[model samples]
Target: MAKGKVGKTVESLGDYLREQRVASRLSLRQLAELAGVSNPYLSQIERGLRKPSAEVLQQIAKALRISAEQLYIRAGILSPDDGVGGSVELAILGDTGLTERQKQSLLDVYASFLALNAVSDAEFAADGDVAAEPVATDPPADTQDQDPQKITTEG
Candidate 1:
């Protein structure tokens, strides 16, 4: 594969994953077992010689007991989503283990965290302008009122 910005990002992701694994005190073989991937494959991923797919990143994140969205961001599978934590919100909503109440609680906390960060970001901006950048509160143009299963093609 051509080594470019994406390649560099994947390499950084590998470094990040290795750091997380070391911080969790799990050996490479142990992490590989937990992630249900072969040791050599995981080693190649950690060494930045291979770019893992989103599914692999999810598995590794689950094994690491961390947010899959975090790994997704590191892997460049998804952008920051205007810093609103939209992907994280979706992941939390899609989680089968969390009850409705639990999901609501988590969403509440996540929203509060975002609000706090927005305030801090505003404070650091010139003249503490909260509206420095227009917030993207709307859904993407392509997805607005569209069915998830349906595909639209423009000729």
Candidate 2:
């Protein structure tokens, strides 16, 4: 990405983080306490004076009760169409009733379901005729047509 674009993304991420924090009714000191970061550091993050690491973002997201993926997208670590559906994930993350563990569990289950469906789709595509072919462990290299802009994330 261009330098200008990156700067804009960082600013946008800062704005988004501030909005989430305010929406959760968390003050800077309270959020910093919850996220295990210094009050000044959290304030710097909200002011776009600092670019937080993935780990810090995760902590902040947990404190805000939002998805880290949302933060990742806002930070330009992942694009809009990177892998998951933003809206669905955001909805799950935004649900105040669900605990952090519950949200993570739900996301894991949802991701597993999507992965299984991908495998099934690949198998069906491989077997032109319906003859109950065995599923392959590895998908074809060209499976899903391969997006060059796709961002890969490691657990």
Candidate 3:
């Protein structure tokens, strides 16, 4: 990614974090405490002065009760396409210059799509066809070491 995009992503993530913090009614100090980061660092993030790694963003997401991918999208680390939609959100993120807030709103609303799936995760995993698949096991290797030269055609 270009430096400009990186800068924008950092600023956008910071902005989104600040918005989420406010929306959750969490003070900077409180959010920092929950995210396991320092208050000053959180402030720096909100001010776009520092770029956080995916792990840090995930921690912040956990603190905010949102998916880590959401934070990743805002951070410009992972594209929004990586969201649950599998590629749908990517197109939306691309081909349109939607603001981070708008994108986040769309993602939040889209998250409800889980309710529309034909089968729940447990049900899908329990399908008969899926259950019929063979399970792999580690096989014992031949422990004997034979000399290649000694293996000549011995009648």
Candidate 4:
């Protein structure tokens, strides 16, 4: 598949899955065989005729060797979380043991975190006119043998 500029706009979950399957050179029947789902079912999923449950999504993801969360993200079901935390509602939804209430709680938290982080990002940009560029950090010569940090303890 051609790499598109807008990943979010370019792919529905089904479209992404179809692309991956095609890139892997697997036919629908082959993917269904590997995924242990019916060919028709997989086809419907690719056509966006159905919304896969988390369990089904996980099964497909496993066959594709990807995280179930990634499938949901591509499907536009969940947005990524922000802040210093590498987390989002999809992380919570991926947990099979969580009750409905727990999932709601996690989603609420993630949404709030995203909102707060958006504001923080705006503030940070406003603070400096510095263009964001890759800073060249030259490693010291023969640095491989040294401990990463000379002092581990904080002052």
Clashing pairs in 2: none
Clash totals in order: 0, 0, 0, 0
lDDT tens digits, residues 1-155, model 3? 55687688888888899899999999999999999999999999999889885557768988999877677667764455444544555544442577656765675565556444535866876774665558786444542365556656748
| Candidate 2 error regions (>4 Å) | 1-3, 84-155
Cα RMSD of all models vs. native, in order, equals: 19.7, 19.3, 16.0, 14.6
> Higher-lDDT candidate among 1 and 4?
1
| Tens digits of lDDT, candidate 1, 1-155 | 67898788888888999999999999999999999999999999988888886567778999999888888677665557646666676676567797757866886787778789989877688565445577669778879888877966879
Ranking by lDDT: 1, 2, 3, 4
By TM-score, how accurate is candidate 4? Answer: 0.54
Expressed as tens digits, the lDDT of each residue in 70-94 for candidate 4 is 7866654465543333355656777
TM-score versus the correct structure, for each prediction? 0.54, 0.52, 0.51, 0.54
Greater-lDDT candidate between 2 and 4? 2
lDDT of each prediction vs. the true structure? 0.81, 0.79, 0.74, 0.73
TM-score of predicted structure 3: 0.51
- Give lDDT tens digits, candidate 2, residues 44-103: 888888888656788899999998987978876545763555656666666779876786
lDDT of 2 at 11: 84
lDDT computed for candidate 2: 0.79
Candidate 4 runs further than 4 Å off: 1-11, 81-90, 99-155
